[model samples]
Target: MNCRRLNIINRNSQRLLFLVNQLLDFKKVEQNGFTVQFSRQNVTNLVTAVAERFAPSIEQMGGKLVVEQCERDIEADVDAEALTKLVSNLLNNARKYMKDRIVIACHADEGQGWFTISVSDNGVGISRDNQEKIFKPFFQVMDDNRESKGGTGLGLSIVQSVVEAHKGEIKVESSLGNGATFIVTLPLRQEGVTASAGNDIMSPAEDKGCSRAIDGGVNDVSRPVMLIVDDNEEMLQFITSNFNSDYEVVTAVNGKEALDKLSRHEVALIVSDWMMPVMNGVELCRAVRSNCNYSHIPFILLTAKTDNYSKIEGLNCGADAYVEKPFSVNYLEARIHNLVEMRKLLREKFSQTPLEPINTIAPNPVDDQFLTQLTNIIEENFSNPELSVDFLANRMGISRSGLYAKIKTLANVTPNELIQLTRLKKAAKLLAENKYRINEICYMVGFNSSSYFSKCFQRQFGIKPGEFTPHSL
Candidate 1:
């Protein structure tokens, strides 16, 4: 038999095995209730293995499957059997809707105690409206031809159950005409604590991982908000004095108070002491990781708890970075700068080159499709003067905030900035051709006012549009 036929056989065998296990799991749930048997498994390998099982089907659909390996192995205390099913269900779900491409990856956010595996696709992207319903018992992406026939309608539901059983969480990233990304995050081993799926120490996973090919994430202009939580007044003052010059620092006595501060402000990073009067740093880390709004913030735990178990506890609770007391101010400062810079780079979008010979910089299919479709939308409506975030978001079928976050994560720019960037790049191209008058070229690229176009043109190209004829351009 050919390799392709063998792949198809392996794919069918995997799916058949998944369904049999599903029946057994249902019986177990009905009789004794669902549960997980924790074992130390290398998550990166698990994700890669499961993705390979679906490779034949993905290929048969005229699609490609890409497995992204992380910088290191991400091991977690999980039920190998259940985790396999969880991954398998996710694969089957993707195969049902996605036809062009599929990419799977796993990574360990050690600071936040999260090990994540994402399966993304580049076909029949789910709409925001259906996202809410897709996880329900019998929901499927709306299609008159394929709607009720996708599967038992229990794949994602089972996937969700498996996630909760492992004390982890799952979420979907997608939009109409943009592909979907199903992100699953699980807990790793933390000493001095028993593994329980009940604890649920995790964030929503990602709105997060963007790549800019050779470049990186855009630095925020508004002094990025930083929150510091330490009960000691002297330490707070000293730390605040040092960092205030670079960051807009806010101080809190404990984790509870820190959360209140977070609610009122959009904080980019956090620094906290492990032992405090009311709520300690570990507790604060857990709280932050559980909240989707603040989970993505980089956390640095600064404290005296320097033991191995203490470090494990701190990281397992979602602390992104750690600093021990009696530390040098210079040491802490350097660590903070490095962590924040890495975070910035991770959020930058793929490449910004034109769409003719497309180069995808995103880590997954969902982002790749979104960027491709977004580029198409911009080009198709290139002459429409009203092309803005709202317009783009409406066309994409996602909310304004969802659009903003995804674009920011994938492109490292605000919606307005992306629109302006697209328009300006087009305008620059027209200028290079020297085909029309400045005002005419401006209007041709969707600019309404000539003066405003000139200002923007100068801002982007470092010269007045008039200075650029064919030779000058």
Candidate 2:
């Protein structure tokens, strides 16, 4: 048999196995005997592996499956076997209803203390009324012809049970024509935690400790831009007024509008409401984190949702912090200041050690990958005197201005300065090796004039090249 045909058979067998397991899980759920065996496991690795299993089959069906993996693995106390089944069922259902693409995103919010996994697909969407019913046992949304697609309809039902058993919650967002997104949020650690269906598992008091009141002085001129989004005009103005003295406050009524503002302005931070028309804060957070341009911006989600699951959902989508509604203005302002200052400190660290590993600071995966690629390119071409910022930008597949901005934000240095630093570091290494004279090493590392190289080296290292020793690094 051909490979494609064999792959189909393999996929069918896996589906059949899952169906059998689903029926067994349904029985367990009905009998209330489905006890989760919780142990600490790396959730990111497990979820990524499960998502990969459906890729070949989805591709065979002329569909695409995109799995967004995190840079850092999230270790959580979970029933590994049950979580595997939960993800498998989600992928299977997406495969059934998806038109051409399915996206799976996984993130862990240490700040909010939740691990989140979301499965989305572009296909026939679910209506608001049916959204609640779709999780019921043996429930399926029939087509216009009043025919079921296929399955016992126990997949999502079992998924919900697994989530509840793990003291987590599953939520679905969809409409008639738009696609659907299923978000499953679980605690980072399941210990001494008791929860029942529809119960608030955690108290807001547990989150109050995260609110730091450190003050970073604000400037009157050239203030950092802050985006405040809310559907309610009153709430929008309220937040804007509070931050007006500190930031160049811009207002948007929804996530779409917020994104429009992001494109037009260099936003320093974002504060948004949870519920709104067009798009909500969680969706906006996800969109911002998915794009490299805005991923590093500190996001603060303001919501009335006090439940543990809701907080996890918001933070897992990449909100740097969460503030419950009717929140203290002082607390909110403190958190905003804390997040901005923390990023500034991180940038300072990176600037001091530009050649350090990206994983050292544990930035988002997108930025980590970008910096890794960038450093590799620079290291490979550092000896080329013709290597310019524009050339590096082209190689990085970004505009010159974008590269300049990213490097400045990330490393607290311009692109040209970064390149020069990279060359100087290389020259430092060569000098430490005691393998060549200063002149030879200077020419070898792309410096044409020894006198100029000496000056730059002294400026960067606070000592002349000849004064550099192995311990100086």
Candidate 3:
């Protein structure tokens, strides 16, 4: 068959398979007394079933399926039907694209109550540019090739959605020609929620209601109060839109205006462009620091210039962090979260010990050591986009559980939380200085998406970054 015809067939097959699985899940849900039952299943068994189901096709394509068993049982609490579909889609993709042997490895740690199910193949792996897009719906890395291979470009996206529904995380490790490994980690069971009661199967509307309720309360507590300092009206509106959620955003076009707003209302954070007509980010930071009342408020400098000297100059002028232009929203959100957490801690400590200096050392040396090591590790990998808890644990030669425990004991935050905080602090400095475009600043701080970044940034700052201009106060 021609590539196009084959692709059409593949798409049809995938859709058919998805429909069948959905029906099966629905049936299973009905049979299981309408309770969401999270059960522990073996990864090896799951992969074997999926591979066997696709054996005929694999054999026709002249490929072999290889299963690798780790020393432990790879177990997770998942809806059996959904989990099965996730595995099947991954394996199906591997078999269709690969010319040789496909390997499925199961790694589990009973102590940690987690597992990583990885399906890999000697096929043409995903390119770096296409990696992120792959999880997005209807985004196929190779449209022409995939057409011939018969893919609807929805397999990975479905996999992602299903995994997220199960409250798990999925990641891809791939490079062109090297092979691709899709790893999924899920909890053995939902913590605090009993499996005996079954999974709480809620309708879409009910789920939305629950989410709204949760978000409503969170919005009240975590709403960001942003102070924007920019001279451009268009830029101010653009920045404000990026952070309206989770923020009571305010705006000013210049330093004086920002300072005036600051005086009138309490702002959690400041996002300022570096080059402004009347008073810039550097000038603003200087002004804020000079004022005894506002010196403690976090400041971020956003600039288009990605020079070492410029960054240093901004930092020296009391900017907490710096971000270059053309940044990702994900990076900016992470940075903002970090700064906000720091400010919260500082405020709490300041309130508790009014007479004491804020710089008092941590009481525990063990915690101090761990924090130092963590800080060093974070600094070393500050530029890495995938620098997360998993990455940190792998780098530190510790298990995820161990890393979490150590971080919680030493830093008073989870490893993931710490990473987010670190990134947020860095982004805050750039925003306060206002040197770069908001989008540019987001990615420069290592966030993958600007919308997500703004949400996070607003959560930390109590206002949108666009409204926290030095001139406003």
TM-score, per-candidate, Cα-based: 0.38, 0.49, 0.35
Better by lDDT, candidate 3 or 1? 1
- Residue pairs clashing in model 1 are 111-319, 111-320, 349-410, 349-411
Segments of candidate 1 deviating more than 4 angstroms: 1-17, 144-146, 190-473
206-225 in candidate 3: lDDT tens per residue? 32211211111111224547
Q: Which ten residues in a row have the lowest lDDT in candidate 1?
A: 205-214
- For candidate 2, write residues 1-473 as lDDT tens digits: 56567446645664576577689889988988568877767687778767665776688789999988687888888887788889988998888888899999989889999989999999788998999899999999887678888998999998998898888999998987787999999998887433422233432332221211111111113667899999865566556645664578899999999999988887878899998889999999999888877776778999979999998898789888999866656689789778766776775554344244444433577777888788778889867766888899989888887777666656656676667666776787788788899999888877889998887776555678888886655
For residues 199-315, what per-residue lDDT tens digits would candidate 1 score against the true structure?
A: 444443132222222232344346667899988665676577556645788999998999999878767679999988678889888887765445556789997778999888887
Instruction: Give the CA lDDT, 0 to 100, for residue 101 in model 3.
Output: 79
- Compared with the true structure, model 2 gives a TM-score of 0.49
Off by over 4 Å in 3: 1-36, 143-148, 192-473
Global lDDT of model 3: 0.65
When sorted by lDDT, best at the front, the candidate numbers are 2, 1, 3
- Candidate 3, position 168, lDDT: 75
- After TM-score superposition, what is the CA distance of residue 287 in candidate 2 from its true location, in Å? 1.0
